[model samples]
Target: MHLSIIAGSSGLVGNNILNQLCEDNHNVIAINRKPISGLHPKTTELVIDFESFLIDGSLPACNHAFICLGTTMKIAGNKNNFRRVDFDYSLDIAKKAFESGAKKLTLISSGGADSSSKNFYLRVKGELEDAIINIGFESVNIFRPGFLTGAGGRKRATSEKIFMKLAKFLDLILIGSARKYRSINAEVLARKMVSTLKSKPGVNYYYYDDFIK
Candidate 1:
C-alpha cells in the first residue's frame, strides 16, 4: 500500500487531501498544530508546534509528502510571522521529510508566485518553491491555484470574498494562459494531487486550469 505524510492537515486543501488519501486506502500521517478529529483508520495524527518541531527517526517514512502549510499576513499579525509559517516552517518539514526518505514532494503555492515579484506574498511563495526544489526531491509538483473555493468553516477577508466574486464573473472570459488564474474547489485540487503521484517522475507544475483537467 502507498503511504504519504501531509503537513497542515487542518487547512482546507490539506484536510481534503487527507480524506482523499484515506478513501483511496492509502496510509496517511497527518502533521498538524493540534490533533485532527474523526481521523480515518489509516490516518495517524501528529501534533506539534511548527516553530519547535524537530526532525527525528520518529517521523514515518513515506513515498510522498505534501506541504500545505500557509498563513495570511493579517492572521499572522505581521509580515515576519507570515513568512515564518509560509516559508520557514514549511521548508523545515520539507527538509525533514526528504531526509526521512520521501521521494516525491507536492506544495500548494499560489497563482502569482514569482521570486522577483514586488508583492511580498507572491515573492515569499516563489522563494519557498525555489528552496524546496533545491532540496532535491526525486519528483517535485508545485500547484499554483488561484482563489480556492471550498467550505472549511474559516472566515475569509473582505478582499478575498470580493476577489472570489470577480473571479466567477470573469470565468467565462478567461482563456489560454489566463485560465491559469481561474478559481477551483479545494477538493478538486486535493484529489488531483493525490491521484497524480504514480505519474511520470519529474518536476511538474500545475496551475488553476491544470487541476480542472
Candidate 2:
C-alpha cells in the first residue's frame, strides 16, 4: 500500500516503520523536520517544518497514513511546545492526509491515553485521539504501546532512560493492570500497525498487552 508517515522517524518507532515499509515495497513518503539519511529506494523524503508545511499539491495519493510524531518535555523544553509537537502537529498532518484522500490513519499513542485523565501527557494523548476520531476517517487505528524498545537517533532524557530500564524488569512481574508497562520492540509495533490495515476496519484500538501479544 502507498503510505505517508509523520514524526518518530528520528525516534525508534518511526525509523522501524520507515524501514519496514520500504523493505516491503510499499511506496512511502516520509516527512520530517530534518533530513533523514539512508532511505530506501521506495521511500521519498520531505524535510519541512510541520507547523508551516503548506499542502500545495506535493503529497502523493495514499491509502494509509501513520502518525508517529511526538515530543517530550525535555526535548520541547516547555509544555506548550511539547503540546505543539504531540498534538497540534499530529492533527495538522492527519487533516492534510484526509484532505488528500487518505482513508485510513494509524496513530501511535500511549497506553494511558484517556480524554478525562488527570495526567497531562496521557490527557493530551487522549484529547488527540478524540480529536482524530471526530475528524472522521474511513478507518482509524490507535496503537497504545508500552515503553518502546530499540535504538535510534539520540537517547531520551536520563530520567526516561532510567524509567525504561526499570520498566523492563517490572514488565515481567505485572501482568494485566500494568500491561501498558510492558516494553514493546519498536519493530514489532510497526509491523502490527501495518498488518492491521489489511483486516476489516472500524476504530481498532490496541493496548500495550494486545500489541505485545
The sequence of per-residue lDDT tens digits that candidate 1 reaches over residues 6-101 is 999889899899988888898999998877678999998888876567434246778889999998888999999999999998998899889889
Question: Using Cα atoms with residue i matched to residue i, what is each candidate's TM-score against the true structure?
Answer: 0.92, 0.91
Best by lDDT: 1
Query: Which 10 successive residues of model 2 have the least lDDT summed?
Result: 51-60
Per-residue lDDT, model 2, residue 149, is 70
| Local distance difference test scores for all models | 0.86, 0.80
Predicted model with the maximum TM-score: 1
Give the alpha carbon lDDT tens digit for every residue of 44-129 in model 2.
Answer: 88787765664343456777788899987877999899888899888878887788788889999998899899998999999999
* CA lDDT, candidate 2, residue 92: 79
**Model 2 lDDT vs. the true structure?**
0.80
How far out, in Å, is residue 61 in model 1?
1.3
